[model samples]
Target: MNQPLLEMQDVKISFTTSTGVVEAVRGVDLSIYPGQSVAIVGESGSGKSTTAMAILGLLPGTGRVTGGRILFEGQDITHFNDKQFEALRGNKIGLVPQDPMSNLNPVWRIGTQIDESLRANHVVKGSEHHHRVVELLEEAGLPDAERRAKQYPHEFSGGMRQRALIAMGLAARPKLLIADEPTSALDVTVQKTILDHLDTLTAELGNAVLFITHDLGLAAERAEHLIVMHRGRIVESGPSREVLRDPQHPYTRRLVTAAPSLASSRIRAAREAGLESAELVAATADGEKPQETVISVKNLCKEFDIRGQRGEKKVLKAVDDVSFDLHRGTTLALVGESGSGKSTVANMVLNLLEPTSGTIAYEGQDTSNLSRKQLFDLRRKMQVVFQNPYGSLDPMYSIFKCIEEPLALHRVGSRKEREQRVAELLDMVSMPRSAMRRYPNELSGGQRQRIAIARALALKPDVLVLDEAVSALDVLVQNQIIQLLAQLQRDLELSYLFITHDLAVVRQTADDIVVMKKGQVVEQGTSDEVFENPQQDYTKNLINSVPGLHIEIGTGENLGLAE
Candidate 1:
């Protein structure tokens, strides 16, 4: 390859804490050639983001490079001062951060934000700047670019906000673009569109990309080269296809096996790998009699009246006559893009939101007519796990307390018994006993999610309303959680109302699937039926939107593993 556009030789980073110094990034070596796309793949706290920060001189708190060098265009930049770094930041190296909502200022208009970046890089000025902003928005795939520019971040959807970020990142035509989990929270179709746009634009502009993410499948699909990181160290690195086909490290193998896209391809793989029970697999077989319904929804409708800018009332039909059934010991996934009413249906079923019209029956009892005491009793039979564990969990509470609180509130057992139950719940979720004393901030994303699951199970509910529960997790953690849910469903005879935009995950964990669009049910059927013979154009589009869908995986032989 030509001379590397960027190189890190034995780079080390550390942060000062009250206890002592924490070595976040150990000695590491990496290189990126001009116009090349490289991905650093790892789980949370694996130092992937830290290495990127080190390159951009944006490390948080007291973090600093303690050893080695970072060379850009054959020039040492490890010791560059902040003033010097600022000169090159937006002009030569641009960044698209993880969370668009948090990164973009809420008070600023979309056009103003992009204008700031363009101005900072001295790319455009005067009347020409406004036109430049519209051009950038258009290039980023936003429709009605001029109108969108005047809107605030809150007016745009998650995917649109991300596109704006991408436009800003590419505003200056930087030589290098660092995208940190840019599409981690987006729907599969939106993710594909954004990634495709980024790839095409970067390639055309001859800009190298340093992509950091926890998703091995996405990394393999998007980048030419892959570098696997584990505990602040490089575990493996090679051509993306070669590493995926024959992972040299055990960690890499785990990542490949855990990918949702690959895992969804064959349900038999779950049973054959012993991740689930044979009986559970048999229950879902094509010829088996239908299971009893646990929760039923009919003619569900939810509408909201909003005041427009001119003070005119507007009726928004968030959910329109949606209906579905959740069978005992089975998972029924509600899949759709953002604002498609998947979460609205989930909320109505959970009784957290009152429907404008319709009936929701739990065990043949109408939840709408349930008395206050009856509703309180119903809480014991149904529990929910949210998308963001960090937001759901109480930072002030320990893991033990978080789980025990539900048991205590329900008066399920004695104080001693509740303590014992908390321990058992931790074990059930595969969490360490030592973790019981730690706060939510002390745990990683996956660990916190496990704790959330443990807490949810403390009530021993018959049904779980999981709203995008595993969408934020890495492939390995997501796989583990999926297997745990399957086993629990079999052992406890629990039903799940799974809501998500990820059809890949829905295919693996859901027995039945419901596809929603613009507050309406576009398609609904068994997982096999929908995946194999999608009836709706929207359903086919969703299936086609899955990343790495066409990338073939080796049949165990390439990885030197037994089938």
Candidate 2:
């Protein structure tokens, strides 16, 4: 075998925390050979990302390599100074960070950022920078590179911004690329496209890839070797399929069991195991659905007139003729890519945004013609929990205050009764009543989301609108949240209008699925009908875009792989 492009032998990384010294990566041994793709998968704080960051000497805060060595081409650079690391960064080891919004400078044009990287690394001459910038963006799957190069990051969408970051990362054609959670925030279709581009680019250039992600399906599908880390230690390492299909560690098994893929509905024989889609359709045929209708949207249409390039009025129809029905004590998922009108539909249902033309009825009452007093009273029965719990919540507000604010706004009860209700709400979400006094900043992402759910349920509403609720959470936390939602729906008899871009999550939480695209409904049916017999090409494409669906993992249901 040829020598490794990069190697880490018994690498021990640590950081100095407020409490004491903590080891983040403990004696992890890894290797990335030339022209090979390797992946390290684990949950947050499992040392996968820490090991990758250490390779480029980019550990944040007080983190340091406490023991062992990291060798590049047989050269020891474990203790390389900032100057040495800079020379190695863009020139040889390029990095594609997790969040493109924060990574790219908001003030500078996208082209300027890529050009700056090339200038710092001396990859292109000053005279050739413009042409090279366009070339890089074009290679990164962007269209009309010239016009895109002149635009700022804000002008681009989430997928476009990520592609720009990839273009910048590979501007110098580095021999070894470190992609850290590159597509975590992207839509499924967008994520698949970006990963495909990376594969082709790496293969053509004969470059090596070190992929760091929390997605086991991605690791198994994208890389040759898989390494699973847990609690700062390597728990499992082998061929991707071998490790994924038959995990030895308990944590690995839990992770495999928790992955919410579409295949779970039917591994071999069933949508809900013994509950077949055909049978489900038959049982509920001829208007046999017994559940009561809670919310009804008919011919929903929303349009925005925006100033175009030259200040001319341009009509952008965000939601066009969309319709769906939400039943009591059930879940209805609106699934699609980003900007596919899912959120717009949800906003319309929440009465946060009025439709240009259509009707939204709540419990057989038309919500569009509701007066001020009626609207104010109706708010107590419908509530929403937005995406990004960090931003949805106010930093200055304590958990108790955050939950109490809604009750206070509605004037539901006295001060003492509100306090008692807040306590009960926390208990429902499984959060400690003691944490009621704590602030949002002191909690983790999962904790914040739990608090957000509790706050959403504060008014004892019958309907819950969760817009990308669990998209920002880790895999384990996401599973927990899904389970919590299930329990809440069953216990409180709440109906959920869940809007998200991930169909994998839809398979887990949604009872009825509505697939949208380009402001139109592409497909709508029960979970079994959609997953078992998808009727549209777009819907089929979305199912195929799931990362590890094609793998041969015994039964498709248990391992959650699709044929």
Best by lDDT: 1
* Candidate 2: tens digits of C-alpha lDDT, residues 339-369: 8999999888888999999999999999999
Candidates in order have lDDT scores of 0.88, 0.86
- What tens-digit string does per-residue lDDT give for candidate 1 at 131-159? 99999999999999999999999999988
- Which residue window of length 10 is worst by lDDT in model 1? 277-286
Q: After superposition, which runs of candidate 2 have C-alpha atoms over 4 Å from their true positions?
A: 262-289, 554-563
TM-score for each candidate, following the candidate numbering: 0.94, 0.94
Task: Judging by TM-score against the true structure, name the best candidate.
Answer: 2
Clashing pairs in 1: none
